[model samples]
Target: MGKLASECETERARTLTKEGISMDSEKVIKRDNEYVLHTYNRNPIALEKGHGLYAEGPEGQKYLDFTSGIGVNSLGYCDLTWAEAVSEQAHKLQHTSNLYYTAPCGKLAKKLCKRTGMNKVFFGNSGAEANEGAIKAARKYSFDHYGKGRDVVITLVNSFHGRTIATLTATGQEVFHNYFGPFNEGFVYTTAGDIEGLRELVDRHTCAIMLELIQGEGGVMALDPEYVQAVRALCDEKDLVLIVDEVQTGVGRTGTFLCCEHYNLKPDIVTLAKGLGGGLPIGAVLLNEKTAEGMGPGSHGSTFGGNPVVCAGANVVVDRMDQSFLANVSERAVQLRAGLAKLPMVKNLSGIGLMVGIEFFGGIQAADVLAACREKGLLVLTAKSRLRLLPPLTLTAHDVEKALGILNEVLTEMEQKAPKEQA
Candidate 1:
């Protein structure tokens, strides 16, 4: 016997809560807490729907989003073109094995290579996988040319690569080194801008140097341009591969196709993920002529690397990152930084384009500011001890003004509520 629609609704409600309470934000949170692993310190609100630069909680509390899902939503929430492309591709050709060819994947690759001047591309599902593939490529390049003993990759301190064992091992922070035992070796760490230290670390065993132009996880600091140039020159001098991990700073997030463009630098390999697919999961390793043949057939691959729908969305995103669009992004970044600079408690600001980090005075807490801003219809993120803002590249002066207003209000409230010694 078939149940009535009303009965089905009642059953769902009962499943949500033993007391037959209807699903709400609190109920959803409780259910997730009970079922899901406690990996993230989740926000209180349960996201329900979003459009443009705004989102709503289960209870319909609107929020002006600055996080952009940590810089993945390049075109903002459910951009019409991006969504349509993804949907059209999903309906037409959802997926196929890497053994077969797909138009969307090929098209996206062409666009990436054309824009970045890279010779080849290898797709992956996330930043970690892309970096993992890059590590493999760097080592293989050295082994193919030199030998096995030259496998060490020098990475900068405070640089974040990814979560995989190899990438995590490559990450220079000691905090991420816990729990994961016996990490892959051959990775060396040096301080950012420390050319002398970097020189000391490199040897016949060193195969590559990997770094993030702007350390997003490490307080959003931009590496000095001169230092980055020095690193590039060193790579050229030492015949070591240079791999720029642009997972967070790529795809127009930093007002450029790649952050390396800011320094007029090029690398043997570059890894991208966060903003490349707009809202979908996609990562790519761009290989230059020096290391184009690093990975041959069957050397490395991913089943879902070049998914049709994800690549479809990424194509639109790439098309939108044209010079004019990126120029607008740079303009908005200036406006955003100018607005933040006017705020009373913002002690210092760092980052380029839309990627911004805010350091505060009077002992302000990033977590407290995040909560207060959420309560006031704004959403932000924290990096280390400071606040991080990765607003959509489509952000306008008007949106920046509204976001700044909310942050100013939150900082004012916190300052007023702070203890005398802290203030």
Candidate 2:
């Protein structure tokens, strides 16, 4: 036999090592800390590469990734099709200013509008930019139709919009408001699901109501469907633009093209990022008929917006969001939710589809759980105090079983260490 399979694999790895394809984890981490900004409290491990649902450390340690690069790797790591599309477009053309049109960009926009039933699409580089565009569009539409002074937009308290000055100001968390002084005006915050309170907040100054259908960073909390319907009705009654920020919940992240599908409502504007471009940087604002004319030339733009390479990658991702793919996503979500619910430490679960949040009882610290999971070859994330899991939608049943087993072991060990009364 031509060398055993394991031997061949070992030989390939050895060759790669000799060629210096991987480096010392400590050295890489040290270099990164020296050069990179200190904004993120990064994990100790230095990831080298990844394939499918797992990423490998520099030292050959493998990790089952539940975070999916914070929900950007919708197709998991290094998907061949996505990579090929990006590479092909890179060889052909990469970046072009919005002054000219490209086939990839136009095709991707058409696909997005077709899938989401939106009238127009504006591409950008990230969720924040998309939201910024949506905000501008809403304000402009209000100014054109209802005249000035109606520029205020109401966002939900506890919502996390983005990191830019405008988006940060729009974020409802008071904790994020520190040191950002005299933040952008015209943004108001209200409790999520309190339609009456939301109504009370709206006035002649209110132009739009923006929210995340599933608050991914705010503890993976899915807004109540009835409340969402009420909000839509209120928007219609008040003639205010409805903006849905699906940055984390869009592009099959929640087992649907958009989470708004689950709620049976289409808002006037939708902001998308994260999973939209698979692993690439891409953001989009989807406009409905009512707000299709909200933006005009010189109103808003991005230099790298609709970059051909990014659009090529996004085309593959969005094209795959068909009925069959989305159905599988839904099935996987059910499997994951059922498995997570069986854990003894899980107090409750929130979220729909692959977007999950596990609230633990017995005073279990989510940070401790995250660290333990990391040590045990699993990568997870935290939203507020809850353990958030946003695994790749393509994760198989076997992957779900394995992940749950690892999580169960971790939680069981933690439970055993808890005080008897608390346990």
Candidate 3:
């Protein structure tokens, strides 16, 4: 009798999975198309819930999440400690304008400053805003001290900055420069890892040289250490501000709290986002003392910046990302890279820590690999020509192995489907 009851319960669960909650995915997609703006090219499925390294769609199908919401959910979905802190803050005080002081924001700022050795911080709501703040600070610093004509900021080709008018202009990709007419001027792009190109570009009009330690969107390319050192020397020589955009690589993503630490270089301004708030939206610009003082009162502000609820969540994230946690991130990277390299279709693998990018041969599209992985109950991301994977730092070895097994199967199938080469 007990066995029969258990079988009945299992059948009920399967029926619920088939029926979904309200309706089928096709109906949901149609409804979304009618109501939601056509901004993102969304997938066919809709996610409903997520745990440590797995997410379930509305259809109740489970998937190992390697994308981690594009690297924002650092501690994974619904982390107990993070959720508790956020809930506590949400219950006590959700938000307050920056005009008044708040405990969580102050505590988070102090923690960030102390950990990073930066003098001060400016809070915002997204990575672009943080970069915008940094750009504004850099421009104001140059204008106040060096006077006019020092406005141009040199960035790297194929670099991914924010989507704001200023940050979009700062972004080096020509693809994003469309539709938006009359972008902000005084931003130039030089080839990555080219010291001579940067030197030639730096002139009387140059104010700063901004870069990402790892080009996340441009296929996870890490800058050469010698090239980075050259840029640092040039910035110091010309008294130009050095800005590092850590929106994707910051907060222990690259085995260090800051990716710049791997290069042994410090920047005048560092912009952070993505993982800082765990799952909440928060962005910050950490500045050195001299550059920080450039912004006086009434210069800049955001209404929802530094909300207590988000900061409370961020505190839990920071606490969990201590030295021991970061070491684990490094170890996982080695494991993932080694596993990926053994795959037949994987031509090359790049990136540091858990921020990995896998390149394939025989003209295998990243989209196809992503689709296959999804079909096999694994979720991943695509970066141009490479398949990107930004798994949660807290993912266990067992989860990693399971996800990699699915990836290997997908890549093998993709390779098998490719056409044979001409003799």
Candidate 4:
């Protein structure tokens, strides 16, 4: 039952065994509940260690990691090179406030700019901060040029930007709007793939348009390619800033170094986080020449942003995402999608590259599927009405096959039990 639910989470705290064993998982979860904020409904297992695409519980039970820490561990769990880079940087000089320059920051900035054709970079601590910086830059650019009338940014309905008040406001979903009062204003929403509705939203007051090439948390939905091209054209015609929130889809998660690469879009600004730091905390806003200078000194800053250790890990990640690596990601995506399409309960698949969504048509809940998978030594994620898979980029061939096999077994079990469940 540990697989089906938080089977082991409710037990009292544990102590050392007769042979002098260390503290087990239950104690940690118990302590966490007592001290930590109740924001997350965390899973039961106390994952103590990880390597490659596998994580081990407190009792040393290994599980295949398909969620990849929600698309943040691009190199999977504790890759050797990434760990070495981070460790070396930490020893060298871990923290130097952004007031002064550092080698790692400049190196990462150049790599990102050269790879993505973005001219400038702003560092932040998370996706929300990155998006906030972008929003500010867009509005500032508008104010600097046109002045006083244009400040609105149009994002797609159901699209997710971040968790901050400004980003929550920028997000087009109404559900996230509750309880967060008086969110930073100047954001509007429109239906995905609807050009006419977009036109109606864009008046003289519009400053920019934000897009998530593949809307990750909003049920893994992707915008139509033709529609994206149309949006790019419209932005060009109107001189509107185009911002792509690639927090989940960037850093080679979508089979390309950046999701915009798949669309051949050189957006005015692109925000990145998640996989960029492998497993460390980091975020960046990549800006093009047209908008690079949009933000000047004294405008924005973060204390721990661009930490040397994080940038070191990020540099390693970026270096490994060359042409050959991204090509392999595309190939793996094809393999996984093909396998998923043949599953008994999967009605369809949405998203691209390693970022995928399995839409079930047999009335099976995505949350149930996720729990069942976890119980069966496989970890997965859920987004809205679908099961989202954000496997690590460095996932091996054996792990992929193992994940698909477990998924098939789960689908079969669900289908077999569906009739009884209804009865």
Candidate 5:
């Protein structure tokens, strides 16, 4: 959901012919503009390769990747274990549709269920699909038991679910309600931490309540633990399913496998993606026993849901987030937060583990600051009006310090320039 510092609008008058020419970064951008959909406003840098916590552009310019491809490159590009696993799986069995059984998918699902203490998992290709499947299960569960007119779901405002029509409808941000009119119905919204507002939205018709423990795209705001507890209690009292969308906050991104773990929660369903498959596309809907039986066979399915290669990559990614690695993430988060809070430009900070959001109080726009960061060989992201950082969990201490130095310098310059511009 971040914008590029500069638009990729450079016009080049070259076209590919029968004799294939190796494309450089600029050429790649031109080719994309020629072929790919214009849905995304992309960064101008066309990356050639990456390793550790850095990526190289077409001209071999190294960039310390703080965005981590919006937190997808969990192991930080070309990670040996993840790459090997994915490669081996591709060679052995690239894909097997839902009609057939695949070892990698089964193994990955079992590992997730065991680690999270969830009853079962439904694999999909992205976070939106995971959430879509979760919504279906919740609706089905209610239909099976409570009967009709109880299918409405309540979501918190400033929360983001996904781009799919159903998930988008479930998303509470009004800005995303653009050209896509007549969105799916049966969804309502409430403000974060407003127990009274949540109660007002709830009635006999509400079947489930979906929430992202931390609203990642909504400026990385974390809801109060007490408020989460209250929601859980309300769900229990009404026999309504609780769904946690951990698409961005799961898989150790929050210093724990699921952010709900930090709140001592066991929601009826939890969705995951983003960092799950290292750099590959994968997603999962983890269900507790209560709602596990609701989704029977033939109710929901995907063709490329649990491709063996993607699951193989996810296996290694999950293994890398074990106890010690998670502890290290927590330590690094503390170090990063302390350093960021001391910067003169940082107005406020929010987030957990390596997922961070920064706001500036010195009249500096998030886009301008990010453009400066990108110019200095740093890649970052913006959520709403805050500059968001999802640096790789594997980032070295030295790299963290170096990134902080760049940020400090940029903030100092902004702070000084703000007054001069005012004068």
Candidate 6:
């Protein structure tokens, strides 16, 4: 009976693979279109397997990955240490209700607090959830101490917060605000790095000012250091909570454990996700002493917030992001930017550390550059008018050279195809 059952499972797996009904990108897209809501404009390629900075598509074509699953795979795909830790923890204990304390979760929280100097940590399932927790904590802190009528949160224009109702409202982009009407109130928007604009908008009713240190989706724009410092001072004087949304820029993406370290500013609240779980889903909100006590028991909860398996993976990820590892990230960023700048199609480069954006000149659209790069066996991302690159932190010098070579070839082809100027 056991042999028969094992044979049955093997046959099922074989059948799925043979029929391409498994995780094939095309098949998955077809199934998703038939049964799932279409929200993303997905690329044509279907990813199947990965190792370090390389991924294989369903067709078995190898591509050098510069997306890193949109900045979620910090250590690259299928990292041995991370996989082993997750597998071991999964066998021992996958999950338990938040009512019961899990050692892995506690250990992860302690590591985060100790490394970041934050007073407390609240776990969740994604970047959006972490930001949501931060928002709730900020509002509750204001309500408990300063009384009612001060619940407004000031987010910068072009900032991408999340898709949840409250976070959607908190998001500053006008495009996301649509189709979700009668939205949550008390969320306001301000221009990025505009000190006067921020001062004008932040009133007694404003309880918190949330921002991304480097707006990832907003064209990879970095906030001015002086402006950040000014906002920190204002938050302190006005008793307002300063929340840093480090969803994409955190976890050594910007050559630091937290992007705030680059500015040397300590925010009232810091939210993390993306690379925290090493490709597994996890998010956290770190709070200082003043706001840490604001969230009491029964105030907030999540069922799978800090699952043991996810925390175990996160522990491994955190352990790998040492000082030497982060310095290499900076060094790679320099190499990537210098290579991109040499391309004739490249107009300007933006962003810091590994999160980079290449702007094309001669009226070439970002979409064009992305499509060209994709066709050349190089996976890349785009933000507005710039070609974005978020390669794995573990990407070697050889992989970088190969990607750059492909990019150069594509850009040259594009230039050759262009029409000459009219005399």
* Predicted structure with the largest TM-score when compared to the true one: 2
Backbone clash count for every predicted candidate, in the order shown = 0, 0, 0, 1, 0, 0
Over 4 Å off in model 4, which ranges? Answer: 1-21, 420-423
Per-residue C-alpha lDDT of model 2 across residues 1-423, encoded as one tens digit per residue? 113434766898899889987567998999999999998999999998899999998779999999999999999998888887887788789887999989999999899888888999999999999999999999989999999799999999989999999999999998888988889899999999898899999899999999899898889999999999999999999999999999999999989898999999889999999998899898999998878785778988899999999999999998888899999999989999999989968899999899999999867989999999999999999999999999988899899999999999999998898886665
lDDT order of candidates, top first: 2, 1, 3, 4, 6, 5
- Which residue runs of candidate 1 sit more than 4 Å off their true CA positions? 1-22, 419-423
Distance from true location, Cα of 154 in model 4, Å: 0.8
RMSD of 4: 5.7
The C-alpha RMSD in Å for every predicted model, in order, reads 4.3, 3.7, 5.1, 5.7, 5.8, 3.3
What local lDDT score does residue 389 receive in model 1, on the 0 to 100 scale? 97
Off by over 4 Å in 6: 1-26, 419-423
As a whole number from 0 to 100, the lDDT of residue 222 in candidate 1 is 97
Best-fitting candidate, measured by lDDT? 2
Cα distance off (Å), candidate 4, residue 4: 39
User: CA lDDT of each candidate?
Assistant: 0.91, 0.91, 0.90, 0.89, 0.89, 0.89
TM-score of model 1 (CA atoms): 0.94
| Worst 10 contiguous positions by lDDT, candidate 5 | 1-10
**Model 2 reaches what TM-score against the true structure?**
0.95
lDDT of 4 by residue, 1-423 (tens): 222123333332232344465657988788889999999989888898788999998888899999999999999998888887887787789998988999999999999999988899998889999999999899888999999979999999999999888999999899989898888779989999999889888899999999999988899998888899999999999999999999999999988898887788879999999999999999999988877675788888899998999999999999999889988899888889888888887888999899999898757999999999999999999999999999999876677789999999999998987874441
Clashing pairs in 1: none
Instruction: Provide TM-scores for the models.
Output: 0.94, 0.95, 0.94, 0.94, 0.94, 0.94
Lowest lDDT 10-residue stretch of candidate 6: 414-423
